[model samples]
Target: MSSYFSSADLFRIAPLVVLSFGAFCLLLMEVFIKGAWDKARTAGLFTLVAFVSLYYYRGQFFEGSTAFQGLLFTDPYTFFFAALILIGTFITRLLSDERLREEGVGAQAEYFSLLLMCSVGAMIFVAARELIVLFLGLEIMSIALYCLCGSALWSTRSSESALKYFLLGSFSSAVMLFGMSLLYGLSGTLVIPDIASALSSMPAENMGILLVAIGLMLVGFGFKIGLVPFHFWAPDVYQGSPTPITAYMACVVKAAAVAAAIRVMTLLFVHGDLFSVWSDAIWFIAAITMTIGNLSALRQRSVKRMLAYSSIAHAGYMFVAFIAPETGGLSAILFYLVTYTAMTFGAFGITMIVANSFPEKTDADDISNFNGLGFTRPMLGVLMTIFMFSLAGLPPGLAGLLGKFYLFNAAVKANFISIAVIGVLNSAISCYYYLNVLVAMYFRKGEVSPSHPVGMPMAGALGVCAAASIFLGVFPSKLYEIAAYVVTTF
Candidate 1:
């Protein structure tokens, strides 16, 4: 045991150590400390912590090594996603501090601690090198998120979301495990690279089992990525969970899941014919997902549910990166994830702020509630406009437009011309709803009421989001290079 564990392993897992320490400290404050905290002071502290964390984990890095006896690995790929997951978590925490401060006893501690726990899990998830490690990492992430969804005990919808997520999430996990078990049986290996080595020259008789295994695993992954047909849970869960957590699910969890999927697809299914078979499946799924997602979003009245369907559409966009991995596809996906995070955080944060203007217990997220928001709250309206346009893949939303450029460019390079065309059509379809939000804010008239002022922490979070979206668009070459570097190690 002493020989198996080493200092290098410690370095490999340092992010988890740091996050676990944060969670433990927060838990200690909850148990040992007494009395309610000062809400403004608490929000300030959260903002400061997020600022400090950003100072350390602000950018992606490229590096590589094996850890935990090759059960887990450290690489530029993992580090890139680790940076993303932490940044998303910090911003979500800032929003949580502002939103949950007025809630009952222990809300702050539980919220912060569990978020840290979930980040740790997400880090483990993307760093996994073996199937069992992957399953364990995913379970850790999922269980923590289930608790986070219901952290708002005051809302029955929150409780319902948690229960729904747990039951369905468990089923998906089981489906993945069965697939993993079959893959192991066919290849006689749990290690991903070893399984890939075995699969490079698979016999015809074993191909059937291999296809079944791959299909099952993809089904499991579809739930996490919010791909259509498997995306039924997303709108309900995103709508019912606390708004900040909804954004977290949209950004952080989706990033982790996509990273994990990239690893599996890039490393495990290497046989030429087999890869083609699944790639074709992914192509069709992407088309249906993008079409169905945008069409469904067009009908939604609630902002959260609309964004939920939008998340599904984005998942389809993620699959476009999968269409041709040989031509810088993963890097395109990485860039899109980064920009999508910026746009989504700002959009959802503004939604929360605007909805707060209405009296409690009203249909706070109705698109109608956003009417006249531009005239009433000019700054928030401007921020939301930036996010919505970016989300719609329009200009001044340079981040989103460039991200899509990279994705569609990769598809064309790989000769998947038809799928690229479908994606463009879907983008046009999405503009209807994305721009509809802006139309509500700037053009429509509703009985607008006075809105609550944003807390310092939330404002800071939104500021970071808006700045990142614009900055990345203006200076994309360097970040795109960094993203390209990430997949080189793989």
Candidate 2:
């Protein structure tokens, strides 16, 4: 093989390079910054670096490239996800500023550094083509997140959340690694395309090992994406972690996992009897994931935990696209991820703002906290309503409704009508809970007094999320076309 380090390779990995560099700088700064104010300035510096990186890679969105001899690949698909993860990180930094101070999470430098490192990992995860590189990226992202989940040293829940996430995340990684080892043993290669070719040439009786490998790999991915049987850690982790970190996991982490799954499953398995062997199993998982997520969400009084379950249901909806890999399924998943990121981040941003408003209430995430928000903070109430409606997949939630429409349409086109129908019914069931929050915000009467004012940073983040959600909903054709183009490349 030719040299992996070249001008082209550097260009392909530019975004990751920039993020890692920023993270390194932040880590070094931690030793010198003794004051909370200095740490806050460092956080701002991190945000600036992230924004610069985002702009630097703006043109890559239209230029498809590959690097490191296919260990890393870039196309519209990778570009979309890389940019999405970076943007999510920037917004999270913005959201984190106030929360860190309010919650007394004093290690601002470490927190910001971990956040950037996590973005680096997520970027790598989406762009990886070889299983080894993919695993490396996954661990980089997961480890940073494990630390960030418990970064709020003042809160015991933060520590607990971090510990739970670490234990579960490590187990999943082991399962995934074992699966990768089995796959390598069977195919004698780590590159995805080579593995597919090897499997095609292998004797039919050897298929049992391949099936088992696929199952193990799914267990690993199922945990990452918060699928039903493996999603036990999500709610506790989401509720216990600092709110901004929860937003990051919900949007960026979930997006990366879905992207990786689409690449690995559709690219390698869609070609042979492999797809049929796993399609029914994936379909069943999707159905149960959706049902259980929605039903469990209904019982949660904590808004953050409720969204946690909602995130699981959304994962199931995305999995519906997986069932129909050939017929617009990839495109549907891409579009839905974009919309999901926007709505989820927006909802969390609003939640953070609401939580910040009532600093004295330890149970700020309780549904009752939002009571009569419409009467006190009318603008927040409206934004929260938009996010809730979008999540529930109702009209005027144009982005979310259209996203679901495309997913179900793809499923129907691929002749997985039952999965699509089940997904639709789950959406219906989810509305009761999503709308329940809206009712508390607008209908119920209660005194609303916020301890801190809403800063421009928080406002800006919410504005971006709301605008994206609305824009995608209203003129989805362009993005839809882009998503379709990306799928063709894959």
Best by TM-score: 2
Give the top-scoring candidate (lDDT): 2
Tens digits of per-residue lDDT for model 2, 1-490: 7664777567667767777887888777676656544554565576576557656765654544667776787877888787778778878887886667676577777888888889889988888889999999999999999999998887989999999999999999999999999999999999887888898898888888888998899999999999989999999999999999999999999999989888887777777777777788889999999999999999999999999999999999999988887788889999999999999999998888887777888888888889999888889888888899899988777899999999999999989998999999999999999999988988899775744578787888898888887889999999999889887775
- Backbone clash total for model 2 is 0
Question: Per-candidate TM vs. native?
Answer: 0.94, 0.96
RMSD of candidate 1 to true structure, Å: 2.6
C-alpha positional error of residue 300 in candidate 2 after TM-score superposition, expressed in Å: 0.5
Question: For residues 1-490, what per-residue lDDT tens digits would candidate 1 score against the true structure?
Answer: 3688776677656667777777777777778777865533443344345435533542322254778888886877888887788788878877766556332213767777788888888888898999999999899899999998988887788899988898888899999899999999988999998998888777889878988999889988888888878888899999988888899999999999999998887788744777779779889999999999999999999999999999899989878878888888889999999999999988999887766666464567899988888998889888998899889988788899889989988988999999999999999999999999999988998785766788788999898898878888889999999899888887
State how far residue 471 of model 1 sits from its true place (Å). 2.2
